[model samples]
Target: MHADTFGTFDDTLASGPRRTPLHALHLRRGARMVPFSGYDMPLHYPAGLLKEHLHTRAGAGLFDVSHMGQIALHADDPADAARALEALIPADILGLRSGRQRYGLLTDAAGGIRDDLMVARFGDRLVLVSYTTLRAPETGADL
Candidate 1:
């Protein structure tokens, strides 16, 4: 309900003053915010991205990737999920080991590309996440 939400950007509706519960917490903890994809996102805290990336590369960064969508399936076993997955994507996703990720491309029945994305098996379910990219979803049909 802040006043800045009503502001116009190039005569179009732009993102307004929205904050996550952690947003206030980050601000309280001296976090810096930046505009990314029309949203006020936290770019860095007292520690910068280079340092954070180095920490992740060296030890652990504990990034806040809550923006990502997480999914899990429980139809059958992992092999079943892989079997269901290979029907759509061109990659041999079934070959992926547990906790491993693989990249694949989506092609039409005629082998025309739609987009490329990654598929990974975390524990029991095959998780898929993509934004504004071509990813072959489960079409529920025999390939």
Candidate 2:
């Protein structure tokens, strides 16, 4: 069967579900695509989830998470930006040095995790990346 049978390839416009840069490659490799967040994401390959999981457990796996949210926080002082972010998440953003990254959790007022994220400190800014379902605009607005 054709790979297109796995998912529709209607990613020609800017308004609907967005396609990652690797969309075509995924189709060629028999990735079953599904709508995720606002993007067309691969659910699995032709190998099936169980076999793929076992294969990865036995060795390694490459995940395509290009559809995840990425928000960049910039300020006159990077430390200031980090401090601002520190108020929201549980990570020590202020202690994150340049060229370093840390895993963090976005928590509710009661200390429940709302989302998991990765914070990376560049020289001039801190970039926050959220998981697949978290959109950049929503996460940025929350911060």
Instruction: Report clashes for each candidate as comma-separated counts.
Output: 0, 0
Q: How would you encode candidate 2's per-residue C-alpha lDDT over 1-143 as one tens digit per residue? A: 00001122333545877888899999999999998866888999998999999999999998776666666665767777777778778778888878888888877779887777778777765454444355344454566
* Number of colliding residue pairs in model 1: 0
Clashing pairs in 2: none
lDDT of each: 0.53, 0.70
Q: Give the Å shift of residue 133 in candidate 1.
A: 9.9
Task: Give the TM-score (vs. native) of candidate 1.
Answer: 0.52
Error of 1 at 128 (Å): 5.7
lDDT of 2: 0.70
Candidate 1 Cα errors over 4 Å, as ranges? 1-21, 87-92, 99-122, 125-143
